[model samples]
Target chain A: MRPALRPIVTLAPLAIVLLGLFGGGLLLGLLQSVGLFALTGSDAFTLSHYRALLNDREFLVSLALSVWVASLATAVSLLLGVTMATALHYGSFVGASRTRWQRTLLQVPLAMPHLSLALVVLHLLSPSGMLSRVAYALGLAPEPSAFPVLVQDAASVGILLAYVWKEAPFLAVVALTMLTRVSRDFDDAARTLGATRWQMWRRVHLPLVAPGLVSASLAVFAYVFGAYEVPLLLGRTYPAMLGVLAERRFSSVDLIDRPAALALALAMSLIAAMLVWVYLRLARQLVGERPVLF
Target chain B: MTSDSASPVILRGVSAAYGDTPVLRKVSLEIDAGELVALLGPSGCGKTTALKVIAGLLAPSEGEVYFGAENVTPLPAERRRAPMVFQKALLFPHLTVAENVAFPLDVQRIPTHQKKLRVAEALALVRLGDFGARLPRELSGGQEQRVALARAIVSAPRVMLLDEPFSALDETLRGQLRLLVREVQQRLGITTVFVTHDQREAATMSSRIALVLDGGIAQVGPARDFFTKPESLAVARFFGWQVLHGANGNWLAFRAEQARLIAPGGDAPPEGWLVLPAKHLFTTDLGTQRLARLRLAAGDEVEVEGPLPYVAPDAAVALALDPGCIREFPADAPATARGW
Candidate 1:
């Protein structure tokens, strides 16, 4: 087979499937948002839905809330992930059996389904759930209700916790792989050159892992921004995440709300597209034309 | 220039093991200050392990490491201040050549101006002054190694450990870098330890060579001593000498170049030389010289190097082994080391 043809032949099937399903649905959704396709009786196209969404205080707040939660989750996960990965790589937590267990434990979240992890987070943080009961039993709170409304709290703390719990492990795995591929001699060289342990990480390991970490963080940020299950289970209804808002609008009994729902979906997709574009540009600057794993 | 004299690196009865596998056993050697010594050996012979022990990267299980009068056995590699240039240049890919060279000074909390001056001087010493702004990936392999050399010497380390730093380069580049390392070491007058499996490289780079066999020093002396007189049968063979089982179970070694071929019915051979009947098996032309392999009457084979117009295969030849070139191993020394 010709070399160029080989790649096209191999990738064609997958490309066709993705473009058919995802691209087709995205096009249909964009058109529907502009009143091109609708089950309701309105035949005229207008920007009213988008303009309404922009002006609607709840929709605007939901979009801002989604961005805030995702950013906070990404920042927390990146820091925790890199630290854990470094610790694991250097054997700060050791013993042959224990090291294996620790590695597996660190990656457990990676294997977990998002909905399942969200359920666990909800149970642990809800007023009447395990953590609240434990706090009450320990006399830290007079009752479960006094433990603070972590689950479904207005701040989306429970949602952030769930996202961090699941996503940090993925970023940690990326960091660990990058660390393992790099030569340990660089660390030794740094130390011999008079660098302290912190300096070694700051100077050697950080630079080595930064590109990979940024790519992974962008993925986590995008996912957290668009993910629905965690926020649905753990977020308040007043300022729901964009995904929840879109879902509620799309599932409403009235059929006229469909275009607005599609509008929100199109907006979210555009935001994700912009994020990916920004990541590509930044990745080129950060990692230099090296083939990005993402 | 280095203010302090080269710190004598001493490893007293050092032994190291990786889990259950012993790599070095009770290895003891002392290198004088300002001396460049090559730890020469085959791959997996623990020469690198010994260098690491001296650098304080690996603490010996049963011995002490000393830098001059200071017993630095407990010191970390950073505390010992012995920088190593690894087989790969290992330049921090993220940093420019200047930053890499200035890393040690930066770590030591030297002022920015002093660090810049030293980095510049070090890069110039390595003949890579113009490459300071370039990243390691931007440089050629030889240039990367030169950058690594600059980094190693920028701090005026107490001891410089080179772990086959030029083995990755081509032969021509290897020779050039070898000379560069020698010039830099002499100019700085710092003690250096070089590890290499290539005999010619070791011989060319160091003032003295320590032949490491089975994880211990088989012999240590001037480089010529290894060629002229190898202390053990293994060392002789390692130097490409032909070790043969001679009269009454004695092991003897002879260099191919020292063995002369004569007619079977020639006049009496010289005194102190052994005469043996041999059949020529093959001969190869090596440009300036001819090498012939012969089967001895005792059913063993030996090689002889002589001028061209070499003998043909299956021809009868009388072999005269020069006495000066032959050395007999002690009766108790193992005839051949197990598993090489």
Candidate 2:
């Protein structure tokens, strides 16, 4: 007979804790779908609710809007992010006081909360906001109304602005992190080969960090999709994003629409899952398997 | 262009310090073109920092560096055209082996056709003609480092800095890579500075060596002279154990090879030179010569080099000392060693 094992006995508590967290999340999702031991037993699984979700146009519009806003925001943020990171990384901007202040200010945006960041955007870009106020004082505008429609305006411009304010910093941070891993040796090699700083970045640094930027942008895309509060406060009605639509569905007073709310949530979940999968798949295709581990 | 590639590259009144922490003090040397110079010392002897300054990756706190007759002291690393290979195989992992070798040319925007030809030539010179298509990960560690060398010389840089490039490899692999680097450096006539902490590495690779101690060059001379006869007491002890005597208020020093194992009970040691065995014997493997350690009664262990085949362990072997290896040091000197 085997002896009572000391190591396994000692490891029992850790094993229970690990499985409780890792396995419990998916199990809870499965149980809620099946109405197993839920607080409300009446909401049982049904095929019609799921079918109605597929047929609903409002849910579909919100889903499409999520993708549209996320992709646009991610693309614009990457362009801005790459520009800002490169300016700071290789530039002797450290010599100028204003550039130093700007560099310090760059870290501030990443630390600020998204809601706080949205407030910052609203304060600075609203028709009656800081820029408009300055314009009013300069006689550029007859009144605040003379300013262009910015807050809750069509084209999702205000919402996209707010999203980018938060997301661009995140992208810049990731870009800087990736840039740090580019070994000086490779750059030195490039220089000896007679590469200018810009040329070195184009040939060496860009290829090395491209994969990380792709993944960072994908993450920003996902973050933009799931942001419920940002669009709820800042988004337009004509092209309502998915987060705003999902919030509306969950808060509807009609009792019969509850199933449709669950269906909308599940639909949003499915789209997000697909985007994430496709993003990872395409990144792997482009970058291949081997690069610097750091 | 350098006015004369035949003249030596010189460092004048060179001193480097970081935040009042002195790293190199009044250190200077002249390295000739087509010469292989080794900066030999234990780590933190400012060997790597010196190489970096020469490569222009670092601007020395003081003094100027000259390539032949022209002063290129203030130039950026790229403008200086000094390529360096790091201890780790620091290849551009993102690029394929061929693309990696082609990187310098691509950066310079060489015509696509010429870039390919240079890459082929560089890879062929390094005996890696067929590895161009493979990524660095596909190749072994030594192969990856060889690709780095190919990239370095593809542009035909005037100076090469090797910061212990092969130090990470095993002994056998290191020897092979050493030969490869030596042959290629010779063929290209690139003035090379190799920084290594291992005495054996410094001894084997360099045409000449500069010994560094306490952030300064202690001695600089031909490798054979430095190895066989180290002048300073610190340099003497750094090589191995030696016996010292006082004559005319100066300290006279000779190697452990002068002392032999006679019958144990001793009133005093023999006239030529004497050392009593301590407690340890470290077996060292030098390429051409194998050496055994003898611990003297003074608790100092000195290495005795002879025609060694394989001696029995702990057997008392008589040493035949060559008095020519004996060196004398200044009596008032301080203690400092720059060795393995």
Candidate 3:
């Protein structure tokens, strides 16, 4: 009943639930990846599945594809999101009530379910879909078949399109929060110091918002790197995203592939953690003493 | 580059409104080049609005602003070349002290070597030369404000607008920075407009003080003129005078320091001096002076400031007010009348 023990007692139940569910699952995943689980019919830990995955060309190709898709999507989304947020912030202050509604309308995509957004992209950008029909009608394409194969393309353009549409709004909302927190005095100071509007944004406003952008962009990158539904619906069959390949291998008819699937999942988690670490280090160097999430 | 080409700023009946609320109304004032003026007033009196009007941050709903002979009404803040230091330091959190000081030069696209040299000089002028590499959050409140001052002056601006730049600091630091600002303004000879609610700050820091009342300037002259001869009863009250009624029904006002304490039943003061009977209520010791609250026989209260060792509470005393220091306004005169 001591006062110092009160907070610990209050948090005990939540901690127990988290440790029981998350920590227990993580331990089980690690054991299964090392071939120590009951399904592997062995108590001895082994790295044979990981070794096989390292040499397997398909797994390596899937890993590279997931990295490429997530990196490109995150980078492009960050640029677009920061630009949109800055523009919205500047525009929203003019006719405050009307442009406030405009800012709210831009957040419609943030509420959308990822799978639903992926399906929407697939329906509109497919070779035989709405865009192709419009292109053919306008004589830009001779037929629906002449339109490029955007949906389920080998380069994952369709998946990238869906992700950018979904996650850019997420980053934009975060960026807008940062932009609004900056005081108007700083902007006035910059302007009075002879900075043009563009220079003020570039030198002062952008640096102020970079901390929030860097942290939020890392979240988007990690999410897209390990996300499942969008890539499965929009990606090609041969060089699939790691998430898609891992799920397929886990559910295969041959039970021996289960360990390899677990290992690949572990690898994805490791890479995401590494990416987060690298990002935090770079952000600290750039932002100087501001707390950056790892 | 000609010396006489720099325009003295002139505001010809400038007025501004926010939505339907009128903040400044038909306010006109002229400021000469290389002069430091303080817009002194209570909060919400449009002191800051006037400063912003001159800085081109706020466009007047009516009237025009001229810098020297050129109409600058349409110019934006970025084109005005007048930098401002805000009430708070408002140093950019992401930038180091050196970078913050160099911001104006960067905006001007001045060469890097000159920018570095000027930044160093500005920092040194603020006595913060050793702290330039530190981030703003790493510095103390006073240091942050010093850095902001450095940043404001580093561009060698044509004019400087200071909006209560030292209001956030302690009294001692405020006085020190006030002196620093005065020295820098005199040394650089940049036309400066400082906005402050503190009368003492306005008096100490500015060559002339403009007393703002009810959205317009009531009087503009040397700081001594405001204390010695306020033009109206409102200006007297704004200067913290406790107005007392004379025998003839004229309103009499004098500063706390203008009254001299006399022995109870002592010989009368010199000719033309008004001797008032009072009872001491209480006194507070300020380091160099004692401030006593005294009530006259007619139930009017007045504050008196004099040398230390104040009389005991509830003791009978006499206050001799110099007729020269007493400003009288006729009973029927309006608050805006020019009462001397």
Candidate 4:
């Protein structure tokens, strides 16, 4: 084989599997959503499914809910993750054994599956769950019924909490990796330049960690936006997350609603792609024109 | 821009450790106001740690640091205002050169116009006036270090710390930067503490050299004193002095250049010169001069450098030492004499 072609040939098998599985499924979904490749009806391309979604208030409400949940979850996770990583990095002076224990504890959340985490969130935040019971037992509340509705509510607080709990540790690991790669001398330099602790965070730590944080946040946001099981287990019935709504339509008894479901899935993908673009642009500004995405 | 007249820095009986491993042990030194002192030592000898202690970047386990009359041991690095230039340029990669130079002022929240003026003045001081708009990545290694220097002094710090700031550069660039640093230090008259392992760099750049050995200061004095009057055998050895044991627990030390070789069976009638018998082991050509290696009768190996002495291998020779060049230390003397 030619030298230049060797790398291509070596990579071809993995590329084939990824493109065939993911790309092929996406292409099929796109065709079905546009009214072509229909399983039962005439396979003719049309935009009626997407047009119907634009006019449907239920779909619009679900879309807005998904955006709201995902945005809040991602923003809170990123903030907490960056703060946690910075604390761990600087707190290393507290002694190696304690720092090691702290780091190990942070990874405990990352080890559990998201489904298990969502269930855990349900058990902890439900009206009659451990927290409400404890609150009542401590005389902070009159009873479990008096506890605020957190799960299966219009606010989607349960789903957002689950996402943050599951994803913040992952983001912290990402940001920590970048933090360790940055030399401690930079911090020393900043300190010697008379930067207070807050100024160090704003000027040095933030910019240095932004690229990794942004990349990891894009992943978290996209995953939370389109995830199905957590929202299904925790979200409100009246106005569901986009993922739950799409799954409901796809699984409905009527076959005619399939195109609308596929269209909703495609819309979720479009929104994720647009968000990734915006994140990449913001990452460029934060990291000083260094190519972050590529 | 002139800083507040420089404050004398003093580290009194400071000791520090990393985990359980002690890095600096009761190291003490004092610098006059406007004096430049180099903390000189071999690698891992705690010179840099001492510099960090003075800069307030590392808290000493014991003892106090003072800036003039103020006890600053409790102050953090940010409040100390002793800016340090590191071995690597360590310029903030995200900021342009001007922003990096202006960073100290920005941290102090100096007004915009004064910040701009000082940044420009610092860049010009480092001879990088036109390069302010470029990022750190765009500058060469030497230029990056220059920018780091500019950033260090831009705040008009009363004292500066430099930790091997030019060791990464090539010899030519190192020489250029050494001169540049010395020039700027003298021009500003800031009390500066520089850390370095290179003797020549320390000698060339610092008004005084503090020789650190193990975790303690061996000796601190004028550069010429280190060469002529080392206080201990260890200090003499560190400066490449050939030491010989003498009677009554005395140690004689002299440099390689101070020894002269005389032909075997030659005259030995010098009044004050000390002479030892030796065998020529070999000769090494050092371009400008040739070094003749010899083993003395007492089993100590020493090298003498001069125009090629006609001594064949295994040929017996007499080594004569100038009494003026010899320093004596007691055999029981500690490795570091602290009071010196």
Candidate 5:
């Protein structure tokens, strides 16, 4: 629209890459005639391999833990993220003060990758880490092992912390960008109608930005749920995340676990699709608005 | 000055600034109980700023605001009994039209049935009955502005502040809404402050117009007098029409309707007449009386409201005006702004 974008016409050539990868994989599945390599010329379709996924304990446990972590992380981050966004957006913190510094500090976490950040958190919270060493120096602990392992703890607080630290800033950025679409006049109008600052934010700003906040939380949920590297580097030994479990199954000595591994991958994809569908359904029903009070 | 004592809303020496830049200077005015006064000025001339200060949205850097003779300068906007109608008619996007008008009642914690009845009455007063179920998106621009007006009035506030509420509407709709505003104000008799960059609209609706500049009132008087007697040259220029100058350079003003065609070297050039070759610039064929804009030899463009006569672009013409039709005063010697 601004006329300066004419040079980006070259990027249209990249459609071939999209068609090659995703389109090629879909075609491979479409061409399959349900095990043509069988000794008998069987003309039957079978979902026996997909149905076999439910009996596996590791896959099921991994699926539950991933959901547990993703839901916990998303809920906690959204609460804090939306609160911070509304405060910074509406509060009286203008013109070269400490608020600008705080905004800058919040963005640094977002600039770093999630894997690097997990390692940083692990270094600080591990038994021989900074917090433990400090406790030992203060004579609060008798020895190094006396301090309980905070990193990769059984409660998954460590994983929750890692997700919140990386994803809250992401949510905040998405929410703040969406906030500009709302009218400031609504806040002013609300105040004139006898609504206090808290009331205005609760009644007006929160409801208006709820859709954006939900979408942002969904975005964070999708990433934290399926993340492979971060969970692999900092996950527990017994109940691994679904991504790590799937990876382990793929690298097995024999290819006997292929069908089960594909089932797990398909399950994770199905959950993510449900989250997206929920967002779309909510978006469709967002037409009704509340009237002003006289 | 004595009549101001009866006013419900009063501002005394109010000054407001943003950071180091002052938006409104020491502005003080009083709105008599059940009267509507238009705070008129150009965009960014501190008109809306004054409205905000009075509404308790912004604390004055100096002076005080009084509602019912009680100092309310320290109060927050929520505590003040003034509801503002913003320029864009900022209806809550999540609320229905009925709910939008009922928002203040909801905040005040009124009963549900009462709110419904009040919202219905408010909607009907704006001639928007049964539009209560519709969203703001479903209404036209004029209708949205009316909804905003309804919301403000439904509060039954002691004072109402409207900041350029009809600016978003087209010209014809704007005039129709202006008349509607006057009719509504007369019926309700609320102490209203209407802020606008339009002088004609202000004169059309309000009982009086406060001509503001530099964050202060330049002149406050009857609506008719503002067009007749502008306090200074700056005030005169803000209004689009002319301040006519006569022989010996006395301050003079000629009414546009008094302008007429004249014969060359007529018996005696009338008082307000300045004979010159007129070139027609534009003409509109209004159903009742067609109007035309013309520029004289002195390059002064005047909008004359009368029946269109035989006149073409670049045509040589003469003007016959009466001296009695013009108002004049002695010029200020130090005022050297010329050819501006």
Candidate 6:
């Protein structure tokens, strides 16, 4: 084999899997959404499914809820993750063993599956859960019924909580890796150059870590936007997340709703792709010809 | 650029450590205003740690650092205003060269026009004026270091600390940068502490060389004194002096250039010279001269630099040392004498 072709050949397995499974599924879904590949024997290609989705208030509400939940979750996670990462990094200087334990504890949520984490969030934040019981025991609440409705609420607070809990640590791990790669000399240099701690963070550290944080937050945003299980377990029934709404339509008893479900999925994919393009452009502007992501 | 008149820096009984391992112990030195002092030592001898203490990057466990008459040890590095250049350029990669040089002024909230003017002057000082708009990655290694030097002096700091700033460069670049640093330092008259393991670098750059050993200063004096009047046997050996045992348990130290090889039965040696019987071991040919290694009768090897003698290997010869060049120390003298 030619040397140049060797790398292509070596990468063939990954390419085949990605194109065959993900690409093929996406192509099929797109065709079905446009009204082809109908089980009812009508093979007409039409935009009726997307047009119906655009006009439907239920679908619009679901779309808005998904956008709201994902954006809030990602923003909260990025902020918390950066804070946690910085704390762990500087905390190591005070006590290495304590920081090590805290780092290990952070990893516990990351190790569990998202569905399992949803259950954990449910047990902690539900009306009759541990927090409510403690509130009642302290007489802050008259009973479990008096506790605020956190789970299965219109705000999707439970789903957002679960995502922030699961994704913050994931983002923290990414930020920490970038932090460790940054030389300590940069900090010392900033200090000697008369930068206070906050100024050092704003000028030196934040820019240095922004690319990694943006990349990780993009991943979390994309994942939380499409995930269904958490919303199914913790969301309101009236206005569900796009993922849960699409899944309900896909599994409906009527065969005619399938195209709308596929349309919703394609819409989600389009939003994610556009977001990724914007993020890539922003990252390019940040680092200036350096490779931010491969 | 308007250079601030430099202030004297003093470290009094400064001791520091990394974690539990102590790096500097009761290390103290006083640098006069506008003087360049080199903390000269081998690797891991705590020279860099001492420099860090002075820069306020590392707090000394014990001792006070004073800038002129003010006790500055309690202040943080940001408040101290003593900038340091590290071994690597360590320019902020994200910022342009001009912005990196303007960082100190930006932190201190200097006026925008003044910051730009000072940054331009600093760049011109380091001969990097045109490269200000470029990023650090666009510059070569030597250029990056020059930008770092520009950044260090841009604020017209009263004191500057350099930790082996040119060590990572090629020899030619190192030589150029050493001269550049010395010229800039002299022109600005900033009190500077330069840390280097290279004795030649120390001798070439510093007004006084402080020889640090075992986490303490063994001696601190003018470069010439390190050779002519080393206080201890260790200080003499460190400066490449050839030490030999003399009669009555005395140790004699002399530079290789101070000793000469004499053929047997040659003219009578000059008065007040110490002559020892030796056998030629071998000769190393340098471009300008040959260095002949000879074994003295007392079983210690010594080098004499000159044109190689006509004698072959193992040929008997007499080595004559000038009494003026030889520093005699009693056998019981301390290996490392404390204080300056």
Best by TM-score: 6
lDDT of 2 by residue, A79-175 (tens): 8888887786776323445466666777887888888877877788787799898888999999876888776776677779987877787777778
Q: Compose the digit string of candidate 3's lDDT tens values, residues A133-219.
A: 999999999998899999899878999999999988888899898898999788888888888889989888888888778888888
TM-score of chain B of 5: 0.82
Candidate 2 vs candidate 6: the DockQ winner is: 6
Instruction: Tell me how many clashing residue pairs each candidate has.
Output: 0, 7, 1, 0, 25, 0
Off by over 4 Å in 3: A1-17, A38-46, A127-147, A280-291, B1-7, B246-249, B259-264, B271-322, B336-340
User: Which of candidates 4 and 6 is the stronger one according to DockQ?
Assistant: 6
Off by over 4 Å in 4: A127-143, A282-291, B19-26, B247-249, B264-272, B334-340
What is the iRMS for every candidate structure? 1.0, 2.1, 0.9, 0.6, 0.7, 0.6
Give the least accurate 10-residue stretch of model 6 chain A, judged by summed lDDT: A285-294
Candidate 1 ranges beyond 4 A from true positions: A41-45, A92-96, A272-293, B1-5, B245-249, B264-272, B337-340
lDDT tens digits, residue span A141-199, model 1: 99889998888998888998998898888888899989888887888778777788888
Highest-scoring model, DockQ = 6
For candidate 5, give the DockQ.
0.70
TM-score, cand. 5 vs. native: 0.84
lDDT (Cα, tens digit) per residue for candidate 4, span A1-294 = 899999999999999999999999999999999998877686988999888888989989988898889889999998888888989987875666767888898999999999999899889889989889989999999997788889998788899899999888888888888888888788899998899989987998788778767777888888988889999989888799888888888898887888878998898789878977886787776676554453
In model 4, which residue pairs have backbone atoms overlapping below 3 Å? none
* Per-residue lDDT of candidate 5, residues A1-294 (tens digit): 445765555554675677788777544333222332222344345565456667777777888898888888998998777777766665423443645666677799999988888898888888888888898999999977788876676767778888898888777766666675677778789989889978887778777877666666777888878878777767887698888887787677655554445556666778777966665565446523221211
Q: Supply the global lDDT for candidate 6.
A: 0.88
List candidate 6 segments past 4 Å from native: A279-291, B264-268, B334-340
Q: List the lowest-lDDT window of 10 residues for candidate 2 chain A.
A: A30-39
The DockQ values of the predictions, listed in order, are 0.70, 0.46, 0.77, 0.81, 0.70, 0.87
Q: Candidate 6, residues A1-294: lDDT per residue as tens digits?
A: 999999999999999999999999999999999989976667899998888877999988987888889889999999999999999987875787989988998999998999998998889889988899999999999997789989998888999999999999998988888988889899899999899988998888888888777777878888888889999999988798888888898898888888878988898778778877776786678645443553
Tens digits of per-residue lDDT for model 6, B121-189: 899988998998999999998999899988888887878999999999999999999999999888888
The residue pairs found clashing in candidate 3 are: B7-B68
RMSD of each: 2.8, 6.7, 3.5, 2.6, 6.0, 2.1
- List the candidate 5 regions with Cα displacement exceeding 4 Å: A1-52, A91-93, A96-98, A275-294, B1-7, B236-241, B244-250, B259-262, B265-326, B333-340
